[model samples]
Target: MRSTTEQTVQPCPQCGTEIRTDRRFTTWCSACDWNVDPVEPDERPGRVERMRRGIAHRYGERLLAEMTGGESRRPRRDVAGVLACTVALCVHGVTVALLLAGVLLVTLGWGGALPVLGAFLLGLAWLLRPRFGRLPDDAPVLHRADAPRLFALIDEVAACAPTSGVHAVAVTAEVNASVSTYGIGQRRLLTLGLGLWEITAPQERVALLGHELGHFAHGDTRHGVIIANALHSLNSWRYLVAPIRNPSGLEVILNALYLLPFLAVQGVMMLLDQLTLRAAQRAEYLADASSATAASTEAAVALQDRLLVYGSAETFLLRESNARQVRDRAKRDEPEQGLWDRLAAYVESIPESEYERRRRVGALRGHSVDSTHPPTHLRRACLLAGPAEPAAVRVDAEAVAAITAELADARRVVARRVLRG
Candidate 1:
């Protein structure tokens, strides 16, 4: 006689729904939208494939949205705008201070103008100085035995454009890579994080390195530093004026005489910083396009996807931690009190809710006047919509040679300036 047997049932990995089956392979859970396939894993396409799809599908749509809304790609300003704003703000500030001092001088003496002029000159010098002293070429190098494959891929992409030769490359455990220019001649430095290396495909890695090269080729390093310096000065002036604008009774009495000039200076600087921020946003778009053109559209998409995933993960984790903290606080016990007293005390003691916390995080990430880089979503969109032609590729040997020669000359010029100082 044959005996009847019962088989065990497992839940679907994708959606968490229970499944009564004898099948050995399971990939999706219908209930919770999870992937349970241990061998196959989740998202079989890898980083590059996912990015390519995202660029093809979502990049154009997002770009259109931002363009129609008149939003900037990045939070920082371009070099020209930064310079214009810095000069305008400084000039206006000096003019106002002088005008106020002139009135005082008429009543008293003529010695105050000299100090005011000296202060103005000092502010100008500070704003004009290069903020990035030297490139990260001097950063310690990390060499792992597994770096050969990654290096080979980078070499292939660099060979595609002669001017794209990397000046320095280093590996770190961080999940990001950055390209920067330092000193005179704008020596390039490329940094890659181990996290990025582990997750990114060969093509995706090439695209990232290519993006850094694009920044170098477009003179973004020098321009970015100039803009950053100008912004820093603007911020400093803003802080200096805040106390004067909203002074205490005693402070107000002391500053009452110079209030007009202080207000004028603050207003001028604020306007300049806003304009500079606008210009920087435009430059970010240009750089994104340069990167896309250097590589293929697919590669650009892949790079953007990787950035978005990393950025989103960071944002989500922060939000989750804040939420957990709130939950923990709410569980604390409290003594009973009168109705109005309890109400007031409860309202005052309540921490930020999850929604409020998330909103704040979004706001910080969405719009940043102080940041030197653009928002991740906007940067990705720009790359997707960038030029299809490979015009940004610097594959010409002569051109690379010229850039190298020019870099050497720039170094000499900077050295001379330093010596003179």
Candidate 2:
């Protein structure tokens, strides 16, 4: 209901320091970071999240040590990778066995409940079948004709990384970017998040591209269809076998029947996670190295610094959306033009000291983009510790301008989606 710029100053009860409080955001003491990120009841992590956090902290430290201790920078296959692949193969084998058993029962068993049992087995087989990754039908896609300048930039990064290029590029409203394969053909796709792209400097954008492409270069096991689908199947199996909290007579029997299977699936999932965790971490470090190789160590580290403040960027977007809602309710005029411009200005206004503080906070909390990756602070340190290579693919201001123009329509659509929330 009020301008985001309108703020009041008050003393932080914790530290007795003056802190600016914006009406649209939490009132937090920047000096002491009081209430900066208050823990809400719902924000408390579940058992699985706690386990993942522990794993992240443990392996994050180990990988950081290995990288900084003059260990080979290149990613190599180890026992963990082999075990992970074997586990995935076994999972697939089980699915095939289910299919064959279902077929045999249906063909050979001609009486009693055998037909129904065979059908049940067939259903299980279908559920456990390996899933081929697919692109989201709703997300906007940019082909070479649609965004030649952008594709040129991606191609440049691909060449620099010496990785096979993507077949298509997809854009989304997320505050992240990633690369993955899709379809039976296993065509590579690059997903560029406008939220992140709008704030990145040209060289930083190159670094981002280089980093995602690096995953392909390093053969990130987690991204492979076999492993990815196995993980998916395991999760699905867990969900299917999970015990119901509230069960009636027959349902109670069903729930009791599911308990053993639920525990078994959980154990298998945990084993798969443990086996693959080290290789996944190594893949990330190698990707970061590739990023530094293509976009320079400075830009790679800068990209990580930008990642630390994505929460702030998301907050800014929320505030803007709320402000727009208030204006609409009051029948006050406010055009939604230049949303990306406003976002860029807001991020650019952040002081370097603020970034440093967030980095420290990330380290304190072992925060990462996701549980799969190391802490952002550790990734930044790894990049900084490596050689400061120059950029292999540079996107100049003119190229950036061209690419921005090409993405103009997509930006408007994404901005509308964000504001609508």
Candidate 3:
């Protein structure tokens, strides 16, 4: 670790990398791995860093033991998140109750002076209730019948992880994989990315699946979805109360009734959202360890490394270049192998520093209070330090062979879908 406080950085003579003078000898250039010497382990991680890493590793170890026939346990729920949803629901309930009471008594008893207002409030409350439905998805779903090998892989991962199983599965063109809940009832959906499959080895693919399954192991989304939906509802009203259109005198007065209290409550909801994010971060750390336990440490670490590379600017450039090639060659009789070759070549040419930037940015895994996951660096540190726990099972070579072939087809299928878009 180097002192990042100093803003001035001089260029490395060989690699043209920016470097602070104090760290020049100890810190390597990420692009070229250029340095005077390797940093000693003791000097790198201080006491507080060691404690956090150790705790994360311990959580992973417990989850790994559970996967190995120990009793299945529920990860703690996010109380703050539930409370946020409760507050949101209470707002809707109170508004509805007041509307009903007003319409039945005030409007009727006051000679119909406020009948129109009461009716309007009733409609507004209906419009603002938490619409407990999943958003529509355009990505193509992969059925077990259509892709047995893929399904087999999914099923195997599901059995090993601490989840009941996903409700649906699909593949996409992105370089990432995710497991999410959809619809009003919180059904699960698993999404696999073709780009990751194209680059990953069989073992690495297992690591990736294990990570998504890990999210389910902790019920990260199903529980957090409430807080998310609550925030979405509140934010929706926040904007709804804004002067989106010119207000009539009567509308202005009604808006004041709704807007003032909503603004005050909206600030409180934001605070709760951050408070509830802690559970998500814990889920992520344990899940990272789960990935390592399911796959080998080697495979898990490799998959994580590739993820960093996947986020780098170089990857974006490579993807666009490949896509442009695909479009250009759409009508060509040229071999498809050439396109794959070109893509591999471009990615191999990128400097290591581009990937390092992803690590420095902490990728999507940072432990920011607002984020659900710990940084990829922290997760990896914990995992690498853990006591040995070999993978429970490796799919037989024949099954691995079958799935590997299916993986290739998946890449083509996803690319074609992207092409259509």
Candidate 4:
């Protein structure tokens, strides 16, 4: 009795199992992948203007999207923070206004009402303010002065993506690469993990560079700071006024008065955060597309696939490699060519089925509702959506090799550097 379309099912693309059309999962393949998609090419920043509710400029984002000719249906997170910042400013202005009004009332010989209210608001604001600080500058950083060759390579990557020049690059023990903007117009900090670089093949490394450069290209780094600060500032405000213990009569009444209004603002911010997170994930997809355009798709795929395997295995490899430098210098007779090959060899010994299982679990999770970054599988899917481009740039072999040699010493000094702290 079912219609033809409803009854029909397509064979799984990867494993040829029947994908049920009648079910909610029409395209998903259980025996193969949970994620199935028709990824469209996109460069449009996002529809963030829709999020500006009070005196919202609804059409501005539409215009931007139309102008860009590509879009992913998620509100831009950083731009949404503009509303948060606006709310913060308004709250601050009101507090200042109350104090000034109170002063005027006292001068005019009015009762203490205005001054008392002003003092209360100001004190609440101060208490509610959140605190955060940047990572220590003393953390071992590699400057252009020390690693010109590496800087040259980074410059090459930036040029291909047409992004701003990196101000400083640092090597870290973490297995990741990140570019962060310190302030609105501040010099961007680029951190490349020795673990990721040590494991990446030359071509695959280009993909990683391209993806990170794409983040710069799209201003994701700059905007990310704004969104983070906005969220933190809001939390600070809430913290300043929230009752620490169970509220007694006066405390309960005061909390109800103070927190009720802010609760609505917090709820709005949370919703905005979710929307922006989706946008951030989409930004990641767009960045992956940029990576595919910069390097070969194979390179991007290889990098992602390798990253999955390297996740658990990498921690072990980095620790062993770092520990070996001091503990077994006598045993390490071989000239250090970097730990990629040996680490990879060890990972390859892992069953393919096991790797697939791990990849599946991670991919299925995608990005959490609040996560600002997308999952690796989502990135892989996005890269696959784009047609492969010929490698647009090559990492300078001489420069990279020289940098790697320097990084070995950098790694050796990392523990000691931290200890110096």
Candidate 5:
């Protein structure tokens, strides 16, 4: 017989509300509605969660979501199957063409057809095999000591994934997280950026992890590796053949002929890549649903909001960095150009007149990528207004202005340093 004590009522830790107690673990506080205990202690959540919550509490939810959810997961592919089909098709096509050419050459007492066939085989082989580097065995792990609560939340979310288990986790300074499959079996790696941790909530962090796990569940990691290898092989063949000069007009024609196989292979690979990307986008939606299911609708909404804002800022920073790199390269290439001259040159290169250029640049300053993720304003509006009647979230023009100004200042600093050096 079951003990009645397991069903006894217990006082809510926060608001003094009475709640039934069936499990040994502490649950939600009924009175104040605060969480009484961490969601899952045995599972380690790591730094991604802590950074997310800290960003949310400081900058509000909208900023956090913008930052986290910008990039969707990698697309899915069937590497082995695709490679086999490609090889078989190429061999059959080349063999039939070579045989017909061989008959013509034999009747005319010519010997070049055999060489052409040899070159084609070599090119095809080169396009199928690719070199891959091993991921380091001792990559550093980011400690989650600073955000214990957030880590606990991640563990709870991870626990919900039944078939595939979560593996290693790492943090980078960029605002990104990805799950990669590198080995022969179920082995995988989950990488989260330090920038991701810097700007989201606990719930949002779980959403990010859940999204990554979705990639694993859908076999995207292995597919990505296969696609990458295929692309690499194609690229390698191009590199090898680029410097070799064709001696005969026939060689030039043969070069064009060789391109057909290359194009056919690449076209298929690209289509597969895009298909994978679309699948990844759908996975994001599913992960978002999973997050809502595991936590709450409100929590899922808040997570999305936080990701948008933060992800935008991070992308802006990266663009700024790239611009600086380009500027530095320009300065190195032309040391004689004056600072004012370089600035003037840059302004002149804009597609508009000086006045219009300034205005356009100003307009672009704080605005996030409108095309990348669903607009932050739209996402927020959807969350606040509900899915059926989704509206745009109200954005403060002043806040955008402020962020733009800050980025402009950073740019100016970079410009000064480059000019001085």
Candidate 6:
């Protein structure tokens, strides 16, 4: 027979009011609610960010409802997708037309002022060129030969996610992980952040990989070359046309001349964002479901819970960085060591009550990792509401040790950079 447990009866530490405590959740007073969310969210977003957040919060709620109601998970070829593609193609066509016109003017209108106009057109075309993503030259790249065990783990997770495997792995000091395509060939690269990697359990690591690779499997339209390059071009155009502050004389006249183009570009950007935002949000939900499939529902939910504490993790990093600076001034004899281990310990030391407090705060504020993703609470809810499946890929102890050994050099390099900064 299965066993059942009940909530533990307790009194509020601050209010002395009796309360029932669920072991799986936070224990806090219902009356006074002491020490809930000690850290408050920043209230200093710019006008644009605020508007985006408002839109994200409203749409995220609607998307969550549809997903939980068992809507189709596959990305469909809809009118929005077609319209977005059409707009992107038009943007690229404009660039191509500019290049051709510039060449024609230069060749046909020799010994005339037309050549000057051609030069100006050519400069504009150069500035607005499409930019493909590239692997950072400075980041340490890990190939499969160098880290077979880690690559094997990634390959296993890719199979479970049913996505094409990554071509290379890069490590960074940030508290995040992502998969991006780079170069003309669009070779996939997985950027793993040591700050997040060190804190996650084995299964949570699988969920992380699954979530990132899931982006590939789901065809996240935001990351596509055509749309991404068009967005980049629009942003560059916006920068070129932006009005300068404290302008005098002809600068003011130039700003006036640029105003109409600025407005036109801004309108197009808004339209494109609106068309793509829904699909992008839906893709995130599907990726979370994929993560649950690969790593089990419990581990996926736990990974989301860990995400809530990243603010505290960042705080710890800043603190350690500050402390490292002080030690350097003292001229310590021994070489610095164990920075990654300490970071892991610091994150692991956070209390369950604190996590619960942050979770509640996130829900109240509609907090998200970025404007692109849905609220963390909604993601957790979707995962929990789905089937409770076992992990599809498992890492034994031998594999874990081997993977850790492979990451040792990367860990050292990242530690040094973090400490020095």
Local accuracy by lDDT, each model: 0.47, 0.82, 0.60, 0.58, 0.44, 0.82
TM-score to true structure, per model: 0.46, 0.88, 0.67, 0.64, 0.42, 0.89
Q: What's the TM for model 5? A: 0.42
lDDT of 4 by residue, 1-421 (tens): 1123334467877788876643322245557564443333244322322232211223223323432455552335466546555654554454456556555555654565765665565565455333333433655677778777777777776777777657777676567887775544556778777667766677777788888877877655225544555565556655665554787888878877877756765664555554454445456665665566667788888788877755566556656656776765455554444455555555554444344555576654433211455556655665665456778776667756787776666665553432222
What local lDDT score does residue 319 receive in model 1, on the 0 to 100 scale?
A: 42
Candidate 2, which segments miss by more than 4 Å at Cα? 1-41, 246-252, 322-336, 367-369
Residue by residue across 229-337, what tens digits does model 6's lDDT show? Answer: 8988998888999888899998999999999998888877877787788888888988888888898889889999989878767777888888877875655434456
Looking at candidate 4, what is the lDDT of residue 184?
44
Clashes of each: 19, 0, 4, 4, 24, 0
The sequence of per-residue lDDT tens digits that candidate 2 reaches over residues 202-245 is 89999999999999988888779889889888988988998887
The reply for model 3, stretches above 4 Å from the true place, is 1-74, 77-127, 131-137, 221-225, 242-262, 313-353, 361-370, 395-397, 404-410
What overall lDDT, based on C-alpha atoms, would model 3 receive against the true structure? 0.60
- Model 4 whole-model lDDT (C-alpha atoms): 0.58
Worst 10 residues of 5 by lDDT: 386-395
**In what order do the candidates fall by TM-score, top score first?**
6, 2, 3, 4, 1, 5
lDDT of 5 by residue, 1-421 (tens): 2233435476766677876543432344434545533434445432333333333233333433442455332333456446544643453454445555545445554466665665555555545444353443434332345333334444555555322544444444455677665455535666665445335444455556655665555443223555446545545544544333744877777667677665665555444333333333334444554445454556656555445334344544454446656565645443322332333232223221222222232233212222112333433343444233121111145533442343333334333444333
Backbone clash total, candidate 6: 0
Estimate the overall C-alpha local distance difference test score of candidate 5: 0.44
Winner of 3 and 4 under TM-score: 3
